[model samples]
Target: MEPHLVTDERLRRVLDDLIRREPLFHRPEFGTTRADFAAMTASDFWETGASEQRYDRAYVLDALEERHQDPPVEEWETSEFSCRELAADVYLLTYTLVLDGRMSRRATIWQQDPDGWKVVYHQGTVVQGS
Candidate 1:
């Protein structure tokens, strides 16, 4: 069976908000629960300038806690994003995150459940040229 693809204004709005300044992931005090995970699977993440990476529920929570000193929000621009269906209820969204004149390719997989859209996977990779 083919996975169901999703393309809705509401979903885009929500995703845009999450990637904007003061995103939930950067908030140390933000609450993250198991509901955000898919079967407690450890998500993959690659932060800019990081040589190695590990991301899971606890890892993300701890990282947020350690990021208590929030940096001043930089002016950022995001390119048009595209989405594809990965499974019955899972969708993969890919876009470019532009900050400080640098662009990073960002991809996130979200799953819809009774609790709404939950991010099951996310990754950001620095783009070298063009």
Candidate 2:
């Protein structure tokens, strides 16, 4: 069965807001500092990479800090965004990301706090035969 790509009308605004920040940590306007990254993610944030390896918040933050010092030139595209409310002030967002002609499906769980949206968890799975 084909997956649902269109977000519900009720979630349109939230979807739009989240989409802009997706493929997370890639937008410079959101900030590139370690502290910025820390603020964007929850204290226990973790992610499963496309490689299927699990990484914790501290490791990920350290890696991001290193990458920021000498960022790589990346050309990518994102599409097929969908969002669902998982609970009060929490949402699950899913989308596809294409980088260097390879595609991966990404999901991020976000929580809205007074500070702003903070990612609780994230995962990426490479699209087979892509």
Candidate 3:
């Protein structure tokens, strides 16, 4: 596969890991090493919260962990798992995260290079705050 697609695929897998409630998702420092997301930080709550009235990946994760455990991987929150390429090197990943049965959205931005992909930016929003 093209390096970009492979990078994107690996990045997508990280997203899936989180949505699927992979216990490792708690590590805020993971995912950065992936060939495709070397520039990204494990999802953050502060950054995410700032994007929309105060919500971040960490915040949501904490909230979710506080209430739910091993949420259904298929039904946890992100009802979907896909991204749209906005540019040759830019892509946006959209998905839902459920914490305490409340659903929120997390958006991650990625940039691509000839060697792999990297998460250049990210943000999250508490759409329902369940």
Candidate 4:
């Protein structure tokens, strides 16, 4: 079976769902490997590597989860999405999350193939003190 030919919009939706609908605390994408299923299966922040070498996903989530703060809404907003760096099967997506009315500094990267798009890497930063 072939994967769906996902557009840049669909790709963003997938990530939005992952962040909005799931237990995930945060997410972001890096400029490293998103092709390895093992890498994707596990979170990146738990591993060890240089700031430029490691692209961890779980680490970002932990950061968010650590934030005991509350927002008016917990849903994420698609501030901007671009595929200018995407190749045929690989692409990068940057998202700004807004939860409970508070804006979250989060970014994510997605990979597409015969299996559609999956969360490869994600990082959430604090854009505001809220």
**CA RMSD of all predictions:** 6.9, 1.3, 9.5, 10.4
Off by over 4 Å in 4: 1-76
What is the Cα-based TM-score of model 4? 0.43
Q: Candidate 3, residues 48-81: lDDT per residue as tens digits? A: 4523555454554455454344434343534555
For candidate 4, write residues 1-130 as lDDT tens digits. 9333334565565445444422233233421223333344433333222233444555544434344344223455545433323555555555455555555544445555465455555555656544
How far is 126's C-alpha from truth in model 1 (Å)? Answer: 0.5
Work out the TM-score per prediction: 0.59, 0.95, 0.45, 0.43
Among all windows of 10 consecutive residues in model 4, the one with the lowest summed lDDT is 23-32
Candidate 2: tens digits of C-alpha lDDT, residues 8-116: 7998889989998988999998999999999999999999998889999999999999999999999889988899999998999998899877899899999999999
- Global Cα lDDT for candidate 3: 0.48
Candidate 4: count the clashes. 17
> Stretches of candidate 2 above 4 Å error?
128-130
State the displacement of the C-alpha of residue 21, model 2, in Å, after optimal TM-score superposition.
0.3
Question: Candidate 3: lDDT of 19?
Answer: 41
Candidate with more favorable, higher lDDT: 1 or 4: 1
Pick the winner on lDDT between candidates 3 and 4.
Answer: 3
Question: Of the candidates numbered 1 and 3, which has the greater TM-score value?
Answer: 1
Instruction: Point out where model 1 deviates above 4 Å.
Output: 1-52, 68-71
